[model samples]
Every structure is written in C-alpha cells, then in structure tokens.
Target chain A: MDQERIQDNIDRYLSGEMNPDERREFELEVSQTPEIQRLLDFNRKLYKEIEVWGKQKLRKRLDDYYSAYLEESDLDHDQAAQTHIADPIPAVLNKTPRILGARWWRMGIAAGITGLLVISMIFFIRQQPKVELTEETPAETPVDSLEEIAPPDSLQGRSKSKPGKEGEQPKPQQSVPGASKEKMLKSQPAYALSNIKRLPKSFVRAADYPQQLQYTFKNGMLTLYGDPLIPPLRLKLFRQKGRLLLQFADDFFFIDPTETARPLIQIGPLSVSDPQPLDESIRIRLANLQESKFTQSDLEVWTGTSPQQIYSFEEKNGKRALILGGLPEGENPLVYVVNGQTCFLVLGSSVFELDNAVNQPVVLRRINGASSANARLFEGSKEFERKVYKIQ
Target chain B: MDDNHLIEELRNGNEDVIKYLYEHLPMVESWIQANNGSRQDALDLFQEAIIVFYRKVREGDYSHDSRISTYLMAICRFQWYTILKKKTKQQESFAQINLFSGQDTGNSSGEPKISQEELSLPSRESYLKNAIEELGEKCKAILEAAIFLNLKMEVIAQRFNFANAQSARQQKLQCLKRLRNKVSYEYVMSLD
Candidate 1:
C-alpha cells in the first residue's frame, strides 16, 4: 500500500470510524503486513503518550488549585484568630462565678470612687477664673481647628508628634484624650493612623505612603488595605513553586521587592475556565437514555431479540455467568476493580455487578436500581438545558 | 456539583474539579502518614490515583454506585499497599548487605550514581517524548489540537492559520511522518 493509503487506514481504524467488517479486514491486512502493523503500533503509542501529556497538564493544574485552597484556608484561620482577639469580653464573662463576683465588686468600688472624684473636680473647675479656663481651651483648640481645616489628603503626611508641637507644623495633635483621637482620624481618608490597630500584628505600617495605603509584611501574613467604608479588598498571600504571589481580585501578582519599579508583576488569572461542552453525539445519546427504565424482563427481551447484545454467557465450574453487550463499538463494559476484585460493571452508563450466587431476578433489580440512578444524571442535564433555554 | 456533574467536568478536563477533589486529600494524607508514609508520598500517590481515576472516567468505566471519594481512597490504599510491599523488599535486600565491611561497592567516588528515575525516562518513553519534542512547538500544538483535543480538521486549520482543512490535514500528516521517521530511526539504531 502507498503511504497515504496506509495513513488513512490507520487513522480510520484507530479513530473507530471503521465498521466491524472493515475493521476485521484492516486487522487481517495489518497482521499479514509487518510494516503496516509496525506503523499502526507506533500511532497507538503516540496517542497514549498524548494522553499522558494531557494528564500531566491536569496534575499541574490540580497542584495550583490546591495551593490556592491552602492560602484561602490560612487566611480564614488568621481572620478567625483576629476576631477572637478583638472580643475578649465574652471570654471574661465565661469565667468562674467566684472569680467573676470578686472582679465585679472591685470594678463597682472603683467606679464609685471615680464618680466621686469627677464630681469634685467639676466643682473645683467651676470655681476657677474664666481667663484660666480660656488659657486651657487653646490646648484643645488646635485639634478642633485642624479637624475643620485639614483636608483628607493632608492626613497622609501627618506623622505622630508630641502635643505642643503644633507651632512647628500643623500635625495631628496627639494631646487629645478619650474620643478626640478617633474623631480626628475619622475625618481623614480611609488609611487613617487609627486604622493601623485594625491590621494584624505582623503588618508594619509602610514608611511612606507615596500613593494609597500600603504595608510591609513581616511574616507570611497577608496584608489587607482598602477603603473601610466599602468591603476590604483581601489580598491572599500565596507561595507557589518557591515564588511568592499576592492574589487580588481575579488576578495574581508576583511579589518581588527587588523589582521596585513594578513590585507586583501581573500574572494571569489563577482560576481555570469551565471545560468545553461534551461531544454533541454523546450528549444526545445520554439524553435519550434519560427515561429508560430497564428491568429484568427488558433485559431478557433484549437478549432474546439480539443474541449479539448478550456479549457472552457461559457455564464454568458449574457456575453460570452472563455478560451483556451490544454497546456502541469501542465502548465496552467498564470494569471497576475495587480492592483487587472486579466489583462493578458499568455498561451503557448503567452499573451492574456479576454474582454467581444471586439469581437472575435479584441481579436484575440491582441493575434496575443502578439504571435509575444513571437516568437521574440525565435528568439533571435536562434541568440545566431548561434553565439555559429560559435564559435565552 | 453532584458526582455525575463532577464526572462530566472531569471528562472535559476542567480544573474546578481539582478543588473538589482536593477536599479528600487530607483523608488520604492522614491515612498514608498513619501507615508509615510521608506527606509528600501521600501527595504523589494521590495525584497518581487521581490520574488513574480520570482515565477510568474517560474510558466510561467508573460507575456511580460508589462515591468518587470512596473510589479514590480504595485506589490510594491499593497503591500504597503496593508501594509498602516494594519498600519492604528493598529493605530486606539492603539488610542482606554488610555496610560495616571495608570493601567498596564500586567506584571510588562517594557520590551516588543517578538512578533510572533521575534519567529522562524508560528508553521507549524517552524516545517517544524526544521525538514529539523534536516536532517543534507549532507541530506539537497542531497535533495536540487535532488528536488530544479531538478538534475537527477545519477547526485545526483555522486555529493554526492554515489555508484550509486539506492543508491542515497535510501539515498534520507531515508532522506525524517526521515523528514516525525519528522514532523508527532511533529504534533501528538501538537494534544495531
């Protein structure tokens, strides 16, 4: 045969495009001709290698997905720990009654004493001259005036300083006590100094904010910095194949401090797109079998009508065995070997097991059960189709 | 997603299935670690079992009678058992050797020789891999699209910017021919 003819025949045979008669003839030709057989064997090996390559690609993808999962899980754990640390009141409340009673009595006595001192101080202050009170008011005046005049952007450059340092440069006065610090910072932009306490202990405030809020990470703890009004943008820290990455939104950015010009190099999205739709013919065939209710009588009728459908039936060692066939060519029964024993046979997308001890009827019921389950899968596809149609 | 939907996704080589499959890893890891295997061993073995499971699903052999996790665990256990047996045999063989003796095994150099696993691969597989690699990137892409992805000749043609389906088919055949020549030459050379 010419090379072209040989290639064509081999493609057809391997692709299962040839009918049984054609396949038999081709096999005969192959067996007789060593050259053709050798070529055919090579093609088969090539196809197998291609399959292995595809599986390796899948394994690589799985590794990535697993890494992403681990990162997210770690982030969750840290967040949970932070939440626990934020609220210690419940834990205190859960203490033993004897310890709680003593602590509560002590707190009550301290509060009474504090209330008496506050009343006496108020009376004494009221007795003071109006000029003296005015002199003290300037100390608090800088904070109120700064809060009114300072633009939100100016807050970024305000470094921590002593209370009386207002004369040097208009900075946020640290002298304010109680709610004054919170009130002052609240008027500022999203990355206020007060918000620093909200961050995890491992994250150090960035030395300079050239742009938006930034933090330098100490440990592997992820640093989240964004507008408090809106939801905080979570940047998951991921270590993949020895390279550090920060996942923000749908994209992953490489974390390399050395690359100061572009510290975060944009890596492509980590998520894999949904797989392509299954083969149309396979889908249609599966859909058609959605309502098939196979029973013992149905099996018997199928066997009687077409002997070829019954792949094989034999008696060995006084034990009868039956193997149902008549599936599409190249789609043989799927033998599921579990625990080193063939436990299940999935034929025609329906499952059945071979048991010599059980009668045919019992085996038939099991087949029926498995077939019904298989049908349900198709039913799910039908529901999906309906949803798609509705959307259209 | 349900098991059936997951199976369908797996058949299409979807990566999302990996996340769902990963949930079962901790179980396998704990089992392997308890059975005198390391976390790395568990990971490698789990990946292999998943590949086997994927092949089975593609071949239409996997039945929904059992859950995917149960099936995976069974495969892992079976594979781990096989590995343990091999390790035991290797240990027995090592036990037979007298390391305390002053005699040298072979070379004077203390450095360990590269094992077969460290090499490219088995001779036949390496030959095939090298042949495919020699086919060049474009040819590999064409072949992968045509054979692995099972794309139509027309689709392959458009994808590779060929003149038409006929040209694409011609290119594919040409690539295959080159691959075959390389593999055959290597086989002939090896035989000689």
Candidate 2:
C-alpha cells in the first residue's frame, strides 16, 4: 500500500495536476520526511539510470558498425587501386592531388614506396656476394656422405625392392614392432615404386594429415596451418577463369601454420615466379640435364655413383609417422614457412603454384629421379629431428 | 541540411546525423591527442558524447539556442574528466585546452552534476554496467525502446507483442526496477 501510495504521489507530482493543498502537503512531506525525500529522489533520477544504460548500448552498436565500415573501406581501397590500373596513364606531375582525398594520398604514398623499393633493390643485388663452401658448411657435398658418417648400426642390414609402376601412392611402410631387426631390414622398401608420376586429389593426400591440417601453397612450398582446437573447416576454393579462388565461410577466423612441408627434390629453375593453377592436372617438367647439369654447382657436389642403400625401422605401439633417415646435410629436401619463419629445403620442383611442388610424403619416393632409391623414405612429423640424431 | 533541420532530424532519431558527427571526427581526435589520449580514446569519448546529445534531445532537455558543437564538446570534456578522475583516484590538474568557453551550451536540463552517492561508492558504475549487461534479452530490448528510443507506448507494445500500451509501460518499469535492484545490491555487497 505504501509502495502504491508512493508511486501515485510521485506520478501526481510529476503530472503537475495536484491541487494547492495536495501540492503543499506533498512538498511539506518531502521536505521534512527522509523516506518521502528518498522516494522522490529515486523517481526523479530514473532518467539518469536510462541515460547511463543508453550510452553503453549505443557505444557497442557504434563500435561494431565502425569496424565493419573500416573493413569495407579497405576493400574500397583495393578496388580504387584496380581502377587506377585500368585508367589511362598521366605524367608523374599530373598525378599530384589538387584536393587531397583519402584514397588519392594513399595511392600516391604507395607509388613513392614502390620507387624507393626499386632503387634499394638495385643496390642490394650489386653489393651481395656469392656464398662459398667452407669447412663450417654442413652437407658440403652428397658424394662424401657415406664416407664421413657411418650408417646407424640399426640400419646395417639392407636390401633393394622390386619397383612398381610410376605414380603409384606408395603403400604404408609398416614397422613390425615384434619382428627381429634382421627380419625388418630384409623386408625393407616392402612396396617399391619407380616414380610418383602423378599427384592425387587433394582430399586423398589430405587423408594422411591430422584432420585439423589446412594447406595453402606459395613460393613452391605447401604450408599446413594448424588450428589448436581443430574446429570444423568451412573452406571454399574453386578455379574461375584460370585464377584459383580461395575464401573462408566466416569472417572471424585465423590460420596458424604449425608446420610447413614440400618435396625434397630440387629440379630445374628452383622455383617458378608465376606458377599456374594445378588442381585440374599434374604436369611434371623433367630437369634438362644437358643444360641444367653443370649450370648449378649443387649438381657438381655429387659426382660419384649412388651410395649403398640402408634401412632403419623402429616401431612402437603403432605410432604413425614417416621416419626420414639417410638424409645428408646438403640438398636437404622439404621447405616451408610457418608463423613468419621460413625453412628452405631443396624440394625438387620446377614450378611452385602448380601441382609440381609435392607436399605429400609420396613425392619423397620419386625425388631426384632416383625411382630405385625412392619408395624407401617418407616425410616425418614436425618433431622428427628432435626424436632422431642428425650428423653434426 | 541546415543546423536547425539537422537537430530536428536528430531529435526524431535519424541515423545519418550520428554518422555525420562521427565521419568528421578530426576535432575530437585533435582534442584527445592534445591530451594524453589516443585516436581510439577520441573515438570512444566522441561516441559517448553523441549518445548523451541524443538522450538530451530525445528527453527534450536541450535548448535550441546553443550550437551542437558546444553541447558535444561539453559532453566530451565531462567524459574525459570522469576518465581522468577514475584513473588517478585523486584530483589532478587539467591539460590546458578550451573544453568549454562559458558560452551557451543550451543546456536546459540541469547541469550534469556529480552526485554525492556516486562519489561515496567507487565500484557503483562498474556494477551498474555489469547488471545492465547480464539482463535478459527481452528486458534489454524493452528497456532500450522505452528509455533510449523513447518510442510511443503503443509502438513499443506493437513491437513487443504486448496486449496494450499500459502492459508495455509496466514491463519497462519492471525491467528498470530489476536492473536498479541488481546494481545497488551488488554495489552494497562490494562495499561490505
């Protein structure tokens, strides 16, 4: 009843319809009585409560709207650049802004940056010296590999395998944990293939990776970005007009490359500056030995015949990983960049963007065109180096 | 449009007016940067100022005699002062900038004075902010419509599917009452 009376009195006071006696009585009650004063104060300051609440709601809505606008602005900036490219060229001085718009000034500064880069590149290339082989250099040459480092005693017993047709996905190189060391070595290279003459569908190759693995290729290297939680992927990629289109299903996302991978074969030209789309088909460009044989000093490092084959098979509790052994320091295959760090390997590929740069471990079989030596080695996990020893 | 028409449009809850105020935010940036504030700080305070202006106009507490810039700058100054006071906990001298020139800000609503109750409880604002945030979606929308949008009771009723304007009004009051209870209860608990 008191709450009702208080609410009624407050309404009557605010409405300004109270008679003189009622008004005088209400004022006197409010002035002298603490409870009445408190009630009046709460009623009057309800506006203040609304004011604060409105500010918070408005701030969030505006900030989100502003960020989205900024993102759209970035796209507009890109389109503006494309427009300039399509338009006719004006002399350098004519391009200066009469009224400085945001886009114009931005493009002008970008042009200045490009000019600076060209001048800097000229000096950098001229001053750079050729790198020479030294005692400090690891993997000086593949020729002296067997002579310097004795094979791991575990791999002393070795044998070659019967070769299969080219382009076959090598069977899983099983490690029999219960088998004797001698038995394992005798059964080494269990399924041999002359060459991995073709690349399989991305999904087929992707089966070998942890389901969380995401892959993209740049500069002849296939990078596998990792998601800690391994959330469901909503990836979209398609070939439109010879341009490979890549897009994400959602706006809020990030790709963390836990490890990067590529084939260890370093074929002709090293890396193609402009690699064409390769999803439709795989085209292998065999190295031109007559021209590229002595053109690179790396080839001269290996003048001798092929070294004796060796095999080391260690299996425990069915751990799945390709154990990369018998690799000499020089011409180490596999290159990648993850989280701003780039590790370059002599992964044999004439072109990168195309299907030529093989990231699947199957390519490790046919690397160096040594089909007989392949079907033996495979790619290892990121922690492979830590688990095994490397020749110092 | 002219300033009078713009103000009128703003009072009627035009989005373009808000965008116009933010699109040309160099003055706010300059003032914030002149103090020890970043561009982000300028944007945040400017947003608050705009909200305050919108509320003042919607509540019919703003006088038409004062320029919009004067009123906005007043709000910005007050926001910055509040931020600085919270940061230091002690009274600090201001960096010299003409936040107000004693010109007519057209403030018919009583001065946005500091309440003694607010000063007495340091954690009150944060608690109020939290309680408002944790409110159910229905309560939030209803309160926002009643208080910020200041829609007609019938319009609010239509939007929320209420039987009548009176029911909508009752719901709005209940939400507000719930929020107040939460804010004060949390504040007193924290003090103890």
Candidate 3:
C-alpha cells in the first residue's frame, strides 16, 4: 500500500467505517510493507495526540480568555455585598420607636383576642357534660344505714361531695405522720404553700422541693406534690384503711406492708412480682372513719391490675387517679407525686410524645374501675373497655 | 481537569474560571509537548491557537456547529502547518511526494499504483502535514476537509466547488505529494 492509501485506511479505521475486507487488506499491507506500517502507526499516535492537545489548548484558551475579562469586569466586593444584605436589620431598628408604638397597639389587639378566647373556652367547658362522680354503695351499705350521717337529699346527686366552685376544688388536707390536726391547723397559715418554694414543716427534713402534705380529717383526704418523698407512701391515707398502692397502666400492685417498711412515698423503678402473687395480694378497705363519712357508693372504684403490673401516678380531674391497668407492654408507668395530694401519671404514649416532640392529645377516654386496678387504657383500638379514664 | 461541571462553569462565565485556567495551563502545555511538539513550541502554539479560538468564539463567529475541540484543533492544525511550512522553505533539497495531484482526474481506468521507494515517507501525521503545508490553498483545503473533518471526497469536491470526488481525490493526491516534498526537505535539513 502507498503512504497516502495507508493514511486513508488508518483514518477510515479510526472513524470505525473500514469495511471488513478493507480492514483485512490494510492489515496484510501493514504486515508486508514496513514503510506503510510505520506511517499507519504514526498516524494513529498523532490522531490521539492531537485530540488530547486540542482539548488542553481549548481549556488553556478558556482560562486566558476569562483571566483578562475578570481583571477588567468590575464586580468584586463580596464583603460589601454581605453588608448590604444585613442593612435591613438596622433599617428596621432605625424605626424602633415607631415599631415599639406599633407593638403596643398589637398588644392591645392581642389582649382583646386573648380575652375573647378565654370567654370562648369558658363557654366550651361549660357546654361539656359535668362529669358526675358515680357513688356506688358497697353490697353492705344500705341507703337507710347512712341516712342520719348523709347530707340532705338535695346534695345526694354529687356522691363524692358536691363539685366545688370553678378553681375551688377541695383544699388538700394537711396531715403529717405524727402532727395533730390542731397543730397542723395552727401552723397551717405558715405551712400553706402560698409560695411554691416553701415546703410544709410537717416533713421532718423536707428537701427543697415543691412538696406539701395536706390532710383533711373530715374526709380523710391527703394530697402531695413535688418530690414523692415528702408524704408517706400510703396514698390510701386519703381513703379508709388506705395503704401505699402502686398502679401501673391497668395493673395494680399493693405495697406489701410486711415487705416495705419505710412509708415515705418514693418515686423510682418498681420490681416485678409474680402475676399470681399480685393476684393473691390482699385488698384492704379504706379507714372506717373515711368509709363512715363516705359510703362505698361515694368511693371511686379502683382495680390496680396494669398488664405490666408496675405502678405509676395518675391524676383525673383534680383527684389523684392511681391506675392499675392501662400500661403498654415492655415499659413501666412514669409516676409524678405532686404536693403529696395528686399523683400525675403519664402513659407510655404520652411519655413517648413528650420525648419525641411537643405533644397533643390524640384520643381521650373516660374509664372507671374498682380498686384502681380494673381501669386500663388499650391503645390502637384493642377493644378492652375495662374502666378507662379520660385524659384531657 | 476536564470535569463536565467545570466546562459548564466556564460556559456560564463563572468567577472561578480564571483560577481554573491558571491551574490547568501548565498541565495542558505539558500534554501537548508529550503528544508531538517541544515544550516551548507546544506552549506557544497551544496558547496562540486557544486565543484565536477564544476570540472567534467570544465574537460568536464559532457557531458551535462542530465540537469545541474540533474547532480548537483546526486552529492548532493551522498553526502547526504554518510553522512547518516556514521551516521547510528555509531548507533547500529535492522534495518527495506520495501521490500525483492529477492521477485520479480521469487519467487511466486501472489500479492506482505506487512504488516502495515512493511510499517511504511516514503517515500524513508524521510527515504529510509538513508536506501538505507546502501545497497550494486548493489542495490544503481539499485535504483538510477530507481528512480533518472526514468529509466525503464528493462532499469536499462539492464544498470546494470542484467537478466531482474523483477530481477531488486527484487534487487530494497532488496535495499529498506536495506534503511529501516538504517532509523530504525538512528531513534533509535535519540531516545537515
């Protein structure tokens, strides 16, 4: 093959258009002719070389093109640009007196809106049916038995005593373990937690916590708040023959008076007792004095049988509602004893919500059970209506 | 260095364009030297070719009908050939050519034959470019359109307003011969 023909064939091959026969013939010529072979090899090398050089040259060209342009382009101060963006803040601040005046006007509008909202809330709350506390008489307490002790028929509708005026629930009765009601009364003015920082003097060495012990001798009611240790553990102190009880979800566990010596209500993890042991646990009655004043009908039924069988503090309305059964599997209830009067319980879902984000109540239920053990909350439509409580 | 994103940035006239070019220039210059030319020559040639390409492109004379590389290479080819032409003319000797300019122009209906001695020059890239630079403009354009752009001989003939591809091919051969002569002269000069 001649040098020119050979060059053409190499170009054809590079372009991927060489016919098979042409390729075979070209290969034969390369093998037989040293000069043509060398030329073809050189052409291949140059084609690759030039293609690379071409790109590099273009890139270098592009750079040079821009370098000259940029030096003369006239758009270069980013720091000044930042100052311009930030200028709005000072501009807003320069109008501060006017803005403050405008803010006062906004405040007036906000107050009016807030007052309207409060009025609307009052109306909405009044519209809701008054949650009548059901007073179920025990099998033995005949109606005639307590007729002399009972209040007039007009007050009979409110079995757990008449609902107090708005924001005027029964004041927590102050009853320390050893202090007499009269001494508790004499110091009541000082012990009363008008300021949240002060604890009632009844607690021997009350720690700096917002805990107060209120004991009502007339109703045998005791309320606690702040650290669980302020008041004795036996919440049944408020009820007749009241014992220290732990309610977990719908499961209830009685503090074994035989096993547990220290009555100071401690908030922490609860041990798991055998399910059967819990079943056999004795159910004690509220004190006779408390029972005599309020019939079994007036007593709120509490069945303390949570599925996990652990204990947590729960509050319903203003009353401390110790739960026995509404616990989620694999977890225990978080108990909060507030001022020794109310035990505020957060269920697992509620706990999870508080942990994950700002929480909103998703579903609400009203459950009532015996001994606080029968009441349980089954989440996600489990369909077990064993005394559920409405948590608003 | 040939990152698609950088190419995009360059096209968009981004502020980083200057820095990118500065960093890449030496590498590009080195690559050209590795490919064929000496370092200094490659740098000068590449720089000039790029500036010409950039000027034409910036002026919008480059329609982008062909690749940026192809356009730039065309400029590089012009610079390379021009340099070779100047060099060859300075040396005086008997010039050799690979093909006759009028052989394919309806000469004889037989196999186009070439002798071993006549076929001794390197491929067009190795020697043909220098040889072709010595040819007339008609031959230069004909061969350039055919070889660089890979235009069909008929298309090249049409593009140059020639009679036909056979005639175009005949013209292309004469161009190849002229390139060989220049190469022969360059070789003889180097021997001295």
Candidate 4:
C-alpha cells in the first residue's frame, strides 16, 4: 500500500470500520513501512489528545453550568432549594422508567424543576416503606374492639374481604386446620393475638405449648404459644451483657443471663431492623437453651501452602458453638463442630476438624472425601473428637 | 436503556428521553470538544441531530437495519464537519486521505510482517485530553457513541436523525479531519 492509501485505511481501522481484508493488508504495510508507522502513531496521538481535551472541557462546563443553575434558582442560599440542586441526575435517570414515563421529558423545565425540588425527598422517602403496626389484641374476646380496627391502607392495606365499608359487620374468622383458635390466641405471650385470621400460615403456632419448656426452630421463629391466662411478656436479649431480660405485662418475669451476645442482625449497613429472628436468633436463643456459652478469648489463624486462612474456636454451652471462617477454596464447603467437656473445637468454611497437640494427637477429620482431599489442609483426624465451635 | 429500547422510546416521543438528553447535554459537549470541536458547536449539532432522529423514527424513516451508534455517529460526524468547515476554511486533509484510502488498493505484497500497532495513534489519553476538557454533554455523547461505543456511522445517523448514512459517513470523516488539523503533528511525532 502507498503511504497515502495506507494512511487512509488507518483512520478506518481506528474508527473500527475496516473490513477484515483491508485490515489485514493495512497491518502488513504498517510493519514494513517506518514512515507509515510514524504517520499512524501521529494519527493515534492526535485522536487521543482531542478526546481527552474534549472530556475535560465538557466536565468544566458542566460544573460551571450546575453551579450557575444552582445560583440562579437561589438553591445555594435556600437550604430547602439546595436539596434539588444536590440530587444526582443518574439516580433520576435510573428511576425514570419505573416511576415516571418517558413523557417526563416532554414536561420540560416544569417537570425538571419539580423533580429537582422533590429529588432529595424522593430518595429519603423511597428508602423507607411505610411500616404498618399489627395491633396485637386479645383473640379470646369475640366482640370487636378498638385494637381490632383495620389498619388504613395508608399505613397497611387491609383485605377487601372485610364486611361493611367502614363500620361493617365483623367477618367470620377462620383458623387454619390443626391450629385451634385457643392455641392461636395463646401463641405470643408478649402481645394479644389480635386478628388470628390475618395471621399467616407460618405464623400460626401450636395451640398447646409448654410453659417452662425448651424451644426449637419451628418453621422460622421461636414462638411461645400457651394459655391466654398467661400474661403478656417482654424479652430482650443483649449480646454484650449476655443476658436475657424477660418481662411479663408490667412485671419483670425472668432474667436468664449468659455471656455470649452480639449486636442485632442488620440486613445492610443501614437498613430496617430484621425482626424475623428465628434462624438469625441463634445468639439470643443460646441464652435460653444453654446455661452458659464458653468462647475462647484469642482467635487462631490457620494458614498453609494454600492461600486459604482458617480461624476456629469453641463455645461449648448447651448448644455446640463453633466460630469458623475461611475454608477450602472451592464451592459448597461444609462446616461442623464436635463438642467436648473441656475443649471446644470449631471448624469453619473448611469441612474438616482435628485434635492437635505438640506431638501426635487425634484430629477431627471431615466426613466428605474428595479426589484431592489428602492434599487439602486437614487430611486425617478422629471423627469423634470433641471439636466445639460457635454455630452461626 | 438498551439501544433498541431507547430507539423505541425516542420514536414514541417519550418526554423522559428528551429530558435525559437535556440532562446529559454536557456529555455531548465533551465529545465535540474532544474531537476538536467546541461546546456550542456540539450543542447545536446534537440538539438538531436528536430532533431530526426523533422525527425520522417517528416518520418511519429509520429502519432498525443497523446499530443505533453507527447511525448517530454518522450524523454527528456530518454535523461536526459542517461546523468544522465553517470554523476553519482549511481543506480537511483527513477527509481527503479517507477518500483516497477507500480507492487505493492496500499493500500488494501481502505479508504478515505488518503490526497493527504501527498504524495506531497514541493511547486515547494523550491528544484527546484538551478537547475532552472543552467538551459539553452533547459532544461527549457523540464522541463516546462514535469512539468508545464503536458504533457504526449508519446506526448513529439513524439514532440522531442525520440526513442519511452517506452524509453521516462524510460528516464523521470531516470531524476527524478537523481534529487531525488541530493536532500538533510535530509534538505527536516527537513522542516516538
């Protein structure tokens, strides 16, 4: 290819328009011809320089525009107006489809101005869904009470099945089969079971429950359903204090204390309080089941030839407590712990456990065997050894 | 939004799309400035182009035969060229080179010795920096659609409603030529 022709193809190539044959030919000439190569390099640099200059200039102009806009609208001075100016355009753009139709653009400056005005509030309000309070009323009383008042749709949507628009006849209540009305009424000791009909199937508790009884995971909540005579109760478990504070009605019923409690469970960094603590209520439940949980003060890190780092410990109370982190590097690693009287061994992401000493001691071995099991960290150990760790 | 989805929206004259375009005006401006054009030039070009695109799509003039980026790039390139010629009377050498390259046969002695790197300009970071700095929202959009998005001329033209693919192609050629003209060849060559 001649220098001029080769140079023309170079632009096409940069713009990614060159056909495969032309591209191949262009590449061939570029290697053989130094002048062409120099020319290509110059073109490339020129394109890049212009691109960078354009972006920088654009950014400066945008900043200036935004500042001027804010100033013109008096948003900079007005605290309330500042909210709109500070609202991110990306966020508005992202939500354009879900909340506003594409016609949002046609509304022009009016919509833009209005949207800007409400931008900060939109973000703040969107993050919080209206929390509906489920009024806990006694189910034993058949007569309609103020507590039985249907929550407004503004707060919580009520079923259309309710008879009468506002001051309607009370609808027939139906309790799920097997869970009798008496049993459902006595489920929660802290609050009166208001509308048993509204209770979800999973929320339905066994009619008869033991008063001073051991609780196990049923469905997904630690429910205490008993006789209606049982007064309302309040139970708050604090991890730091390691105590279970239970109050019935106005009186403090019991204070079952322990030593291993953690902060409340949080979904994200800043999110609503996760009250559904059946599986998540491990730390609090441990207080009721186990007399005391024993946790090792120091955390030991297990490192080997592999990059995997494992930390294990034990809290042997009533329930086996194993704290484990960092395991085998593949998918679906299992965790288990064997309990003993004196020592608590914890296995984490790694599916293995072992008993160790300065010399040779029995080690807990993982049950699952693999092709490369021997090559992994823990290959051999006794299965029955007491390896205790805190369970999640 | 997906390009096709956006095209549909634009065809429907969705207000949100228009608003979004207005909001991202700075991006188009940046693209223009990056390609050796000015913010004001980019604004006029982009505004006109988008409206034209909307009208075309509304009028069923555009067929979904090509990627949206390609068509819009074509229009933006053309708009840019018109602006460039008006700004600078100098005959754009890059455009001439582009026209010449199309007719000129590639290297006859086909060999594997040639490296694609030899034909490449500097990394996008260097020369385009100043232009990008001068860019507004519309310019940035046009540049990114053409350069970063690597869209075809026809698609961009259709998206932005340029007259036609050929005009779009010519326009892109001219814009690039303008940028080439502004570039300091001596400084760029010294980097080697």
| Candidate 2: clashing pairs of residues | A139-A330, A167-A197, A263-A347, A264-A333, A264-A347, A265-A347, A265-A348, A266-A348
Docking quality (DockQ) for each candidate = 0.08, 0.06, 0.01, 0.06
**Poorly placed runs, candidate 4 (over 4 Å):** A1-8, A17-25, A68-274, A280-392, B1-145, B148-151, B159-167, B182-184
lDDT of 3 by residue, A1-392 (tens): 35566656665654434655775676686677767655554444333323322333344445455446435434553432343344323445534544443333222222222222222212122112223212322122111110122121221122232222212211112121233333332323222211111111111010111111111112212221112221122222111133434432222333433421222232333443321221122222221111111111111112232211122222222112232322333333333221111122333323110100101111112122211111111111111111211111
Q: Report the C-alpha lDDT of model 1 over A22-136, residue by residue, as the tens digit.
A: 7668878987897887777667656556544554455667567666555555554454345334533455563555444333322222222222222211111111221211011
By DockQ rank, best first, the candidates go: 1, 4, 2, 3
lDDT of 4 by residue, A263-286 (tens): 222121212243233322322122
Docking class of 2: incorrect
Question: In candidate 1, which residue ranges exceed 4 Å CA deviation?
Answer: A12-23, A74-392, B56-62, B98-127, B134-175, B181-184, B188-192
- Local distance difference test values of all predictions, in order: 0.42, 0.37, 0.32, 0.35
Best by lDDT: 1
Better of 2 and 4 by TM-score: 2
Better of 1 and 2 by TM-score: 1
Interface RMSD of every candidate?
27.2, 26.9, 37.7, 26.5
lDDT of 4 by residue, B42-141 (tens): 5445544454354345434455332344344334544453334322311233334547777542422111121233224236334455545345554555
> Candidate 4 chain A, which ten residues in sequence have the lowest lDDT sum?
A201-210
The regions of model 3 sitting more than 4 angstroms off are: A1-11, A42-392, B1-159, B163-173, B184-192
Error of 2 at A279 (Å): 82
Candidate 3: residue A128 lDDT (0-100): 25
